[model samples]
Target: MTALPHHLDADIWLLHMFSSQAAREGGVIRRKVRDVDRIVGRDAFVTEMRRRGYRVYENAGQFVIFCNREAVRRVV
Candidate 1:
């Protein structure tokens, strides 16, 4: 059997990413939707974000993840 790609493992990648100072400080993170899909899958990404009480927004094939649980409001 062939080995799976490293990115296919979401837990490890998520741990690494979230362990960063920026993430720890609840800074915004931007990632490509295709990258997330390829790494952790779109559903898994969304589920993980929700589980962590974070917010996610999608636009133009990109995903903007808010690392904090604060309420988000849109301003016109």
Candidate 2:
């Protein structure tokens, strides 16, 4: 696959890592949105995930993202 833009690397990587982990363990991926904003704006990061078929939510101070419906259902 083609590489993501430099500014989006960290955000995408974190999303991938959490999604992978969640897919395996049926858990939600909770991340600090501010951290993502440092590399790519929080809105952009969230938009990217949404575009990729992931669900994104802001709870407390973090972004909760999940790839699989089962994972999301389990977490919720």
Q: TM-scores for all candidates? A: 0.81, 0.55
Q: List the residue pairs that clash in candidate 2.
A: none
Writing each residue's lDDT as its tens digit, candidate 2 over 8-71 gives: 6775666566558565575557777776776567777767776766777787888786755543
Residues 1-28 of candidate 1 have per-residue lDDT tens digits of: 5655776577887787788887799988
- Full-model lDDT for every candidate: 0.84, 0.67
TM-score computed on alpha carbons, candidate 2: 0.55
Error of 2 at 57 (Å): 0.9
Lowest lDDT block of 10, candidate 2:
67-76
Each prediction's number of clashing residue pairs? 0, 0
TM-score winner among the candidates?
1
